[model samples]
Target: MRTVDQKLRDRRRRHILTAAISCFIRDGFHRASMQEICKEAGMSPGNLYRYFDSKEAIIEAIAEDERKENATYYAKLFRAKNFLKSLGKMLGASLKKASDPNYERIALEVAAEASRNPKVAAMFAQNEAETKASLVLALRDAAARGEIDGQLDFEAVATILIAVADGAIGRMSLDPALRTTALMPTMKIMITRFLRPPDGP
Candidate 1:
């Protein structure tokens, strides 16, 4: 029940976001002007403005897109039968994404922006809360199934997991030589040993 105009609008919006990301990655977020994004997007200022009033609006849209992606990923993790295995796979996938130079740059930019912009902070904070909650629920289910230690503090563990990912992102950004694929096996062993039930064989 979608109109052609609506579909076209959506496509245009995505196009603008893709162009904006490239600009933002090439230059820091503060240096990436709307005019530059317009040029990158192959659109006039008036047309780009119709889609996004300002850089902040574009950033908000990007955050929303990321939130949706995280939601979908966490939903799948919650439904997974093997929680530990699923969590390991999720972490591995996240590390792989963080290894991408563009993704790392964007992530660092967003984190810096969140510190300076209250609205950006709140948006990412909400996403973080939802992600942690989903992880906690998944962990609880895993405990119930005797897959992990029931006595473990799920909230703290969830926080640690997120922190580890953030740390990995930071490290990869700083050290180009650090390979996520090479580190994944060690990461898997650490997560397995940390979460597995005490009596687990």
Candidate 2:
């Protein structure tokens, strides 16, 4: 149980994080300043500092929120009765989210930065591991239910699926003009091959 004061503080902290994410999405992480974030959050510098020690802390908060959201999505996916249908929906949802220009810009930029910054890289690695675990669970369930071949390696297959999805999103970010018709067929072929059973119909 949380006290009212504690709840209020949590709410304010979430608000500040939301504002910071919006600012970071609109302006690259390197360009977005604490002052701008404070202004967007409707909090003074002192108040913002009460919630986050620094801009880096705010960025981490934003990244953590995204990680949690992805986890929740995977949870829902695991709960789905028809694994194939759920997988399709999950891929569609991810593609739609990635299509958002703001999300694309910030996510791609942060990922690149993480490659160069030890702190950011550590955070990203932690998030990636958690996400991979969730994926492995989902893939295992799918295999148990016969949606995927039982003999295949769940963790490795999950890794490949995640990599393909990430690559699709990255490619879309690079060339928004490419028709989904052109790319989705390639994806469908790969997925169909993976999901196909050994025995003939």
Candidate 3:
């Protein structure tokens, strides 16, 4: 059902984005130039322009990719059997991702860019809202199954979880030497105690 030309186009777009990410990571988003990105992609400006018109376009594409990735992750999480355990694993995986220097740097840069760019802010906000909603639903389901406290406010708990993730990412950015794996045990214990229903096994 797919044509060769379409496949090639998709490949080229991915190449461009890969190059752009490297450039953005090396030289913050604002400083990364289209020319530099073209060089990194091993393409001329004329060719690269065919895929993305400007830096903002590239940023938008990256944000869209992130949104889709998050959706896929949440979909899998929702299907998981043990909600609290799955949530803990998800948090740990997220912390591991944040521990990557390049990822941490890019995340920080995106956060900074979002503050000044309304479009970027809106894009990230939508992703945040969607992720939080999914988390709230997961919390409610877990409660119904007696995995967590039934009386706890799922919405507030979801928000706090998101905040905790953001804080972890921010902390990683600030301390490159910090190892997320070392912190997991403590994090898991805290989450389990906070969510486990009273008198739970």
Q: Which of the numbered candidates is closest to the native, going by highest TM-score?
A: 1
| Runs with alpha carbons beyond 4 Å of true place in candidate 3 | 1-3
The lDDT values for all models are 0.90, 0.79, 0.88
Give the lowest summed-lDDT range of ten residues in model 2.
178-187
Candidate order, TM-score descending: 1, 3, 2
Off by over 4 Å in 2: 1-11, 178-189
After superposition, which runs of candidate 1 have C-alpha atoms over 4 Å from their true positions? 1-3
Candidate with the larger TM-score of 2 and 3: 3
Give lDDT: candidate 2, residue 48. 88
Please report the candidate that would top lDDT against the real structure: 1
What would the per-residue lDDT of candidate 1 be over residues 144-186, giving only the tens digit for each residue? 9899999999999999999998898889878999999988888
lDDT of 1 at 41: 99
**Candidate 3: pairs in clash:** none
Per-model TM against the reference: 0.94, 0.84, 0.92
What would you estimate as the lDDT of candidate 2?
A: 0.79
In model 1, what is the error at residue 141, expressed in angstroms?
1.5
